[model samples]
Target: MMNRRDFLKLACFSVVGTPARSVFDRLTGKDIAGPTKEGQPKWAMVVDLKMCASKPGCRDCVDACHSIHNVPAFNNPKDEVKWVWTDSYKNIFPEQSHRFVSVEVQTRPVLILCNHCENPPCVKVCPTRATFRREDGIVMMDYHRCIGCRYCMAACPYGARSFNWKDPRPFIKKIKEDFPTRTKGVVEKCSFCEERLAKGLKPACVEACTTKALTFGDLNEPNSQVRNLLASKPNIRRKAYLGTEPKVFYLE
Candidate 1:
C-alpha cells in the first residue's frame, strides 16, 4: 500500500543523525543497514513568540537568511521575495484567533518561516521532484530540476512558496558567488539552512536572533533544545488539524 513518497517518508522516519544522501543510498541497497525503521531525528524549529513579539522591527534573521541565500528583493510588496519574514498573528494564525483577543497581540508581527512539514503536500504534487523531503525530514527544492509549473506553490497551504515573477539580477544588490540565483519562473522558499547544517552549523536565522528566540534541533533527540522547549512549554503549530505535521512550533 506504500507509494514512493510514503516509502521516502517511512525511510526518513528511521534515519536519525545521518547524512541526507544516505537515505537515497539505502533505498538502492548501498548502506549496510539496508532499509531501516529506526526512529531518526525529525529536524524542527521553535519560535519563542514571547521574545520575538518585542523585536518585530529587528530583521537580523531575515537579512541574514536572505543575503546568504542570494534572495533578491523586488521592493514591491506584491512581487517582493522572502525566505523568512514577519506578519501579524491573526494573518498567520487566522483559524486560532478569536474576536475577544486583544488588538496588540492580534496585530503584533510574528516571525514567519517554512515549517518543513513531515508530510509535505508540495512534495506530493511536484511532477518533477523539484521539491522533495530528505530522509532527515527537511523539505528541499531543486531549482535546477524545477520546471516552473507553480503546482508546488498551489499545493502549499502555508503560502510559503514564492514564484519569481521577474528577473532577480536587478533586485539583488550584491550577489553571492556561492549561492545560485533562480531565474524568473522558479519557485523558492526557506530551506531550513540545509547548507549550513551540512557544514555543522546552525541556521542563519537562529544564530542571528539576539533574543535567542529561534531554536533549531532534532526532534528525535529528547535532550535537544527544541525538544526541551516542547516538553516544558505549550507550543502551537500552524494548521495542525490539516495533518501536514509541521516541524516548526511557536511558543506563545
Candidate 2:
C-alpha cells in the first residue's frame, strides 16, 4: 500500500503531468474539465451524521472552507455566498422526515454543498459551458465565461451555486492568494478544493472537521474510506429519486 506521502506525490504527478491540460485546467488543477466517464477516479464524500451531531454548534468546517475559498460574508441571506453550510434535516431530506420523527432527527444539522452529480442539470443548461463536470466527477465553474445568466443556478436543484450580485471582493475579510476571488456577475460554488487536491491535501472542510465527520476519497478505490463507509453503514443521498446520481452520501 502507498503511504500518505507517496500517495500525495503521485497525486501531484497526476495533476501536473497529464498531457494536454489546458491553462484553465492547470489553474483549476483538474486533469480534464468535461463530462467524466466510468472507470475514472470518481471523487466522492461521506458525511457521518452521528459524529457531526456530537458538536451541536460547531462551524469549523464551514468557516475553514469559506475563509480559504474567499466566500464573502454578506451577513445577509439574500447575498450570502456559501460553499458549505448546515440545514435542517427535514429541509435536506423531506422524504426521510415525518411528524413522528424524533426532534433530534428532525432538527439534525446536515451539511450541504454541491452534490457534483453524475448527470448535472446545471451543466446541461449552461449555454456557454461555464459550469462543467470534470473527469473526476467534480462540477466546476469558469467564472470568466459565466455571463451571470443564472441558468446554472436555476437549473441546479440543490441551490448550490451562488451568484455575485455586486462586487464580492469588498465583503471578503481577507483573500487567500492561492484562490481567485470572483467578480460581479459571476457564479461560483464548491470545487471540492481541487487546488488543494493538486497539492495532495484534503478539502478545507474535511480537514477542519475535528470530529472527522467528513470523509473524502475516490469511489473507484475498493478500499477507500468513502467506499468502505458506504458499504458498511446505512446512508442516504439528497434527492436520489431525481436520477442525478449525487456523489455525496450521508451516514445515519
What is each predicted model's overall lDDT from 0 to 1?
Answer: 0.84, 0.89
Candidate 1 lDDT at 146 equals 89
Structural similarity to truth (TM-score) of each candidate: 0.84, 0.85
C-alpha lDDT (0 to 100) for residue 224 of candidate 1: 90
C-alpha RMSD for every candidate: 9.1, 12.4
Per-residue alpha-carbon lDDT of model 1 for 137-205, expressed as tens digits? Answer: 888999889899999889888888888989887789789998888888899999999999999899999
Decoy 1 TM-score against native: 0.84
Worst 10-residue stretch by lDDT in candidate 2?
A: 26-35
Query: Candidate 1 — what's its lDDT?
Result: 0.84
Residue 165, model 2: Cα distance from true site in angstroms: 0.5
RMSD of 1: 9.1
Model 2 local distance difference test score: 0.89
